[model samples]
Target: MSNVKDTTKANNQLIYAKRNMWTGILFGFGIVAFIDEAVFHQLLHWHHFYDKSTTEIGLVSDGLFHAFSFFATIGSSFLLADLHRRHAFWLKRWIGGIFLGAGVFQLYDGIIQHKLMRLHQIRYHVDVFPYDLVWNITAVIMIVIGIVLLYRTQS
Candidate 1:
């Protein structure tokens, strides 16, 4: 029947849209990670922005690991969003909450560990102030926005 055919076409279009959206988000995250790890770390010698001493390099490495973890979390969020479209409600909600919680924790860590304690510095800055509040704030804002968008789309 024509009605059945029309319904199938619409369902296929919805799936295609969701797939494209998630792919785009993952691609954007990859670009950001590439810039941070490759251009900033290797080419510029910026390495964690401060704590340049040999002993402090370990701490810097930890920070890099944390950064990578954040990206991985976002990728997982995309997967959850896709699953949600396929009727996996509980799984989607759990992943959404996890993403939101991780974003909040990262913001707090940036403030306390990096800014208050002066554990690291923002690169290319002449000032002794190690913490770049601007960068931290922008990161938090982006994370929150992404989480909100994901939640809305899933709902």
Candidate 2:
């Protein structure tokens, strides 16, 4: 009987961790997108989301991006609520997921968008190298923290 109970508990933990991880990823992506759009695109006025196009097109693109991020956040919220209802959500794991997601999104933008696609640099009218270095380094740090947290949760 004790053995059966222990097995059940372990199984439950694994199940919860898996579910929470997915939720964390979605939430993470949404958060990163929100921050990038809000900070880089708006507050700093670094560069529009789509600068290759006209101003009207850039604004339209930003609107679409905002909409996507909003939907992702909404989806994450619903999933989190379901997890809470089941009493299976793990805060540490969820946080880890957020860090992972944010790092991934940032890295993707830094490497793929800014580097490969030439979409836009970190800032247009400034020294781009410093900004890019700082941006990528931050992303790496977040990813490392996320990895550590998620690994700790396994115990």
Please state the error at residue 148 of candidate 1 in Å: 3.5
Top of the candidates by TM-score: 2
Which segments of model 2 are wrong by more than 4 Å? 1-11
Query: lDDT tens string, model 2, 50-148?
Result: 789888887887888888788888999999998877667788888998898889888998999899998777888667998899899999998998888
**What's model 1's lDDT at 3?**
92
- Predicted candidate 1, C-alpha RMSD: 7.4
TM-score, candidate number 2: 0.90
Q: TM-scores of the models, in the given order?
A: 0.45, 0.90
Candidate lDDT scores, in order, read: 0.54, 0.85
Backbone Cα, N, C clashes tallied per candidate: 0, 0
